[model samples]
Target chain A: MSSLAAPLPATATTAASPASHEDRSSFAFLAIASLFFVISGIVALLVAGKLQMPTLLGNIAWLTYGRMRPLHVNGMLFGWLLAADMGLAFYLVPRLCGVKLWSEKLGMATMYLWVVIILGAVVEIPLGHNQGLEYAELPTWLDVLVVVAWLMFAANIFMTVANRKYEQMYVSLWYIMGAIIWTAFVYLVGNFATLFTTGVNQANLNWFYVHNAVGLIFTPLGLALGYYFIPKAAEAPLYSHRLSMIGFWSLAFVYVWTGAHHMLHGPISQWLQTVSILFSVMLMIPVWTLVYNFFATMKGQWHQLKDNVPIKFMMTGTIFYLLTCFQGPMHSLRSVNAIVSKTDWIVGHAHMAVLGAFSFFAVGGAYYAIPRMLKTRLHSQALANASFWLWLVGGLSFFVSLWIGGFLQGLQWNDPSIPFIDTVKFMKPFWSVRLIGGTFMFGGILLFFWNLLATWLHRSERPAETV
Target chain B: MIKKIDKNNILFVAAATGFFAIGGILTTFAPPLLDASWAKPAPGLQNYPELAKGGDAHADLVMKGRAIYVRDGCWYCHTQQTRTIEADTVRSGWRDVRSPVSTPDEFVFDKPHLFGTRRVGPDLSRAGGKYDKQWHATHFKDPRSLVPGSAMPPFPWIANNPAELDAMVAYIQSLGRAKDWRPTHDYEE
Candidate 1:
């Protein structure tokens, strides 16, 4: 076990290496993010139970469905997934650039600030101090702080890229840069511009932020991590540079137009809805191109999935990513949107991407990066494998039940014969199933946290105390 | 071409920005500014600021109710927009009659519009005059009592505060009440 203390041979392709604190920074971000993941998992379970029986929490204002729903959604998106993605970004950028992170002090500062912003959300959102926008629900002051935190992050990443020892960039680097730029632009427009606007325009702008927050930020960031880890874990080079180009460019162009699809059959303009659907279907091009690139890269590495846990996670995520993308485009069609627009089916589809796909990628990235960052192997690979099964089975059950339930609910809704309350009653059984699945997912996150903590505190190796 | 752009930082960033702007401008930025519906007031909103009685006080109650609605995250469950679909028209009727499909003009006064994403309860678009104030008060206190199997979280706190309760009921009753439409339903307490 003492052998773990021996320094990891520098993995950078060039002579430049990461600063010592970079390791600490990445580990801190992931650890805090994982804590939020666990917390949000508990919140999700409670929220799911409340959906089956609304009186579960006994009329507490703070624990009501409305308050807790945003907490669960934002907690998972910003508190868990985005935080984990940032940690992974910190891990990947320096290594890819063949240089130290631009500023270790700034990186640490940004991590702490990110934690503060998330904490503010946890406190304020449940207290009913939100912007009322779907994804941009944080209070105004907290939203301002978020912009500042993100800017600090973006500056560090860009400066690192600028100071790279390697002149030629990897595909992962492109995605990272794109994620930074796109997030800054969209976050500003969503949070700030919406403040100035009102009525239908506000709704339009709000959807733009909601969709892009996932598409431009998390999607690109998750893909960057996936691109790096899949190739590395499979011990194979990326399959097609052409596919990479086609995927990256097409996604960048197409994703922005599709936010309006969320408002389809509602009050948005006909032409806007038409353009959104057109672009949404065009989204298939990027998704397939990327999926093919990933699968092709895994050629002859199929056996790695049996032993390499990171590869297993990345592959599952890639497959789920394919499904999520397809479902999203299909749901945008007028006929399909009419059935599933506001149902639990949208909820199911949402979880497929954030949890089944991107969360999987982040977990895989953490599995790969955390061990390397700490200079030790995971404390319990068995526990890691157990958690994976829990996530997969639990996630599938949650998604499938909701999809079925939401479809039934939608059908019942369209039939004038059935009363609204009956539709709500019809969903009770599915919500119960969802709650059960959520419990398993919550258990999975606990194990995930336990495994990471054990790996971090494992007696064999600890990071040096004095820098 | 890929290699050249990938190697040059400025060009790569420029290309990314340009592609993002092309779709972003067309979908989100351009449409609202260009559309006439965004600025025009709907017929339903014509008398919203002036009720039949207690004009300023009634308007104040509606605004206060709007704030309460936003604060409680009511919009998360009860969507304001009535889609131009059969399900919406049939389910969320106005005083037992189907209201017209929602228009952009109807939302002119709503800052940070509450066109919510989900229907965890029911569409509140045509909620006005569908139930009496007493029904709303009872519903808020315990949703399942009136409509069994409702998953809506009870706002029992509102029952203790008459002012807030009245405001909430007023705001709900203000929905979908065009110049021609009038409050008709009167439920027994």
Candidate 2:
């Protein structure tokens, strides 16, 4: 009855007592891991700010700008975002499924194993042991560990679902399990494909990995969180189960075809580019569907956003997700891709989705589940508001500065009259502005850590109506 | 009356898995089925033949440079591909260079391709003949001293290690050499 192959019994969700005592140990571990990775990310950015300065740090091989850049990227991608996602998943999945974790030990092992691998990457990648591929920068050995870790995670989730007390599965569950399967295939192939591929084939595989990893893994999982938290906070059932089905199936159908949009105008086949662009445009269907579903569910409960931090974050995240999707398809067009292909606009576009949308969803999910796990109220709503505003201002400003800077760079580079050195000069002001934006982002993340830690440690405030 | 759906149905998971596999297979595997050449680069593709002819061409320097490039995340800022578009081919006036657009065959030997995701710096597809070795050495030591207002950081660390500096330069210089292979070779086609 507790394995993935167990037969389902036609039953109502009445046997809740057996599953109520879910494991909190993995949740606590993941939460702590997320906070530390975020701190490292902040440090990496601070070093990056210095590198952009006129007198960059001198002759420290390990701390060189080039080395720091990968550390910064990986520290954030694998370290901060992945850790946060896993932490929240470990917490939310059990509660939603109405079951205890099938194996808390396996969950903890995944968390610890992931942290260990990322730690190795932060050190090894900077020391020049990288695969020289974006997102796949971690060495081959570490990649193997990652594959093992995800298998363990999938096994735990499968078994837990097998023993669930409910007969009606939620949409979030569908998205989570689907993403787990999709990303495992995407990640393994992306990381391992290079060993067999050469030249343009390898290039194609790399983009496939990068684009699908985000689309299949983060996009679906992030949507799952929004699907779960938004409705719960609104005290409403989903607006339409029919819309969820449409969104999920269409997303599954189209997202994989859209990866080649990253290779538009490159040496890839013309047909590949055309197909990718078409699918990229079609992606609007799922994105808009989710947006509509989220907004409609919030019909009368918009007022909850004032006191409810999870709802506020979830609302902002869905809007940013909308923006990211719009920007993505438009930029994927060959004409538009030709202009912004190599610009900071691409970087800015990535941040809007990864940091602005998915990160917010992860934080919102943590706020909801963390206090519940600990049987407590949030430490401070004011502080939570402060954190949200700081990230909103910081994240938006960062995107703006990079977007304008990248556009200017694109125009200047095309005009051969302008020297490349001068183009770099023009971007100095924008880089400085980006540093300031990063500092605010760090401040916001720091505040989040303090709120969570304080709440976990001292149960001082009178518990409010559980959020 | 509502029907109770099997919330934990293995069949549902199986169906989702099938959809994911089909989508991936279509975009990734189907292309190679259409054009077999894409599955593998043409046999015996030459990469940097000039560098190979230099005899000291242990590939050691270029390999080291590629590793350094990866470590320092240089690919974040600089692209090696001269894409097949007017902006890249006709008047990519960056550094006052008029470079040819890259062909698909050029990347045949790249083990882990360096088609960079962003372009904070100018594309380096034609970088080899663009600058002198001294320019690279001096620039890496202190970028602002050479070109005022440039946002590139001085890698004084690499500047101190002469061997690593040479390796980095060699790799940068070898970029876009894939097109150079076509002028002299015979293709099976």
Candidate 3:
């Protein structure tokens, strides 16, 4: 444990490196977003518990399972993960472009506006001001605010890149730029366009929004960070620029067609489902190419996993991304979709992508950037390592438990002889395991947030020699 | 052209957007607006008869009930779409009778469609008339009383507000019944 927690001497060189005075907004965004990360965990814990014992907060209309579920989903996806991604974007775009941000003031304004959007979600979603769409639950007005905030963010990123000193862009820039464009289109279609339509067509549109919200928005942001930080952590250049290009273009093409896979075996057209299945399988091409590129970059740097905390988080994220991508395409198969589409298995699979894969990348970004931004050593490396392990173990246990529980539940649902109540009863032990796993994961995130906050506050006893 | 895209930010953004729009337009944007079959309502949903049932006052209650259902996040747990699978047919059927597969017309009245992805409970697409309004009321008050070990949260607040409960029950009954396809008596176990 002592060796694992040993102080990183590399921080000294980075601390001596030139500080980007323009990164103030990045620092503020990362810190505030980390706060949401902690709060979202608390909401998730309560929601997980309520699933096992429905009456835990049964009487409270606001905390009921229905309202709480969306609150938890939106809070984590939008509030924590997305906000952190934006912060990473603010940090990466400028450095990669070799320029200060176009306007730090606008960046700060975007951060505050984002906080307001999340706070509005926290207040209004509980009051039943929901849109009733799974991921698009925020009311129409808040949706408008989100679009406005994103516009401000995109303006900053695009303007910064436009003024870049370097003519040739890195892979990270392409991903970030692609994400911004795709997000605007996907979000508007999901939140606004669906308003005019109802019934089956609306359901078709809803899933298009749901799947792309993850694929177009979070996936690109996560990859942008991973592309930047993975090589940085491994101390190597990307293995193949051509491979990265292939991965990007292919993903952009294949991902949008696969959203209908969510509706397989349902009432939507069979041709549409078939198209989705084909694209879903094709998704493996980009995922594997990216995996191969990352692993190849880290070819001889494998031993760094023992000592470098950020690389550990990132490499593990890469592996989770692989597993999640593999599982996702398989789930889209008609036979598999029949059993698991609505079961707890889908829930577990979702967490594997968001919590296990992308969350790790975002956390690694913080671990890599925060100290550099602050010009200080981390408050405690040991605590950071401990948080990583706890998070890994907790996330895996939570996923595996549900995978087993939901599979059996899906099998039982298919069997007419087994009563529905018995299937619900069978989930008890698995839910309990999930709750326990959630607790550890929550504890780890709390430590992570505290470490970063403590570093920002200069709370560490170590000398602040740089200042 | 590739070199120009690599060096020019605006050109690169244009290329990225172009690639994405192809798939987006093909899959999501085009289908509902242009497709012929998707616009056809099922015979039951051909008219908003369910909404017009019992004159304006009853229609108001049903609308209010739908609001409560959405507000309480009921759709998170219970899906409104019944797939064309044996499991759904077996599970949503009345006793041993197979309920009709959910057609597009069945959901014509559902604005912002409630075809939820997961079924934490059961698919409620054909849930209309499966049980009596009284049974739903009792279940809302205390789900465990009727179905022990049920994970459904008790909506005791709705019970306290009798009007709201009635509206919710009405809305629940209207789920698949907009077509009046099933006999109410056939649903009992």
lDDT of each: 0.85, 0.75, 0.85
Docking class of 2: medium
Q: What stretches of model 3 exceed 4 Å from their correct place? A: A1-19, A459-467, B46-55, B178-189
* Runs with alpha carbons beyond 4 Å of true place in candidate 1: A1-21, A459-467, B1-3, B46-55, B94-96, B179-189
Question: Residue by residue across B50-159, what tens digits does model 1's lDDT show?
Answer: 34235577788887787789888899888887898986876766545666778888888786698999998889887776688878889899988998878888898776
Measured against the native two-chain assembly using Cα atoms, what DockQ does each of the candidate structures obtain, in the order listed?
A: 0.77, 0.54, 0.79
Ranking 1 against 3 by TM-score, winner: 3
How close is candidate 2 at the interface, in terms of C-alpha RMSD after superposing the true interface residues? Answer: 2.2
For model 1 chain A, the run of ten residues with the poorest summed lDDT: A1-10
TM-score of each: 0.94, 0.90, 0.95
Docking class of 3: medium
lDDT of 1: 0.85
How would you encode candidate 2's per-residue C-alpha lDDT over A1-467 as one tens digit per residue?
Answer: 02211221222332632334444544555465556656675665756476377365545666666566777777776777776777677666777778788887787677768768877886796587777777888888899998998898889878887787786778888788888889888997799976687667777778888898889998988988888888876788889877987898889888988878888888788898899999899999999999999999998888898888888899999999999999999998877887777788888888889888998998887777766655567788788889899988988888899889988887776665566777777877887777778778888888888887777655435343532
Per-residue lDDT of candidate 2, residues B1-189 (tens digit): 112323545776777778878768877767766755564543433554344546656466887787777777777777877787655754432243356776666666676777887766667765654566778889988877877766676787777788889888877766665444333222111
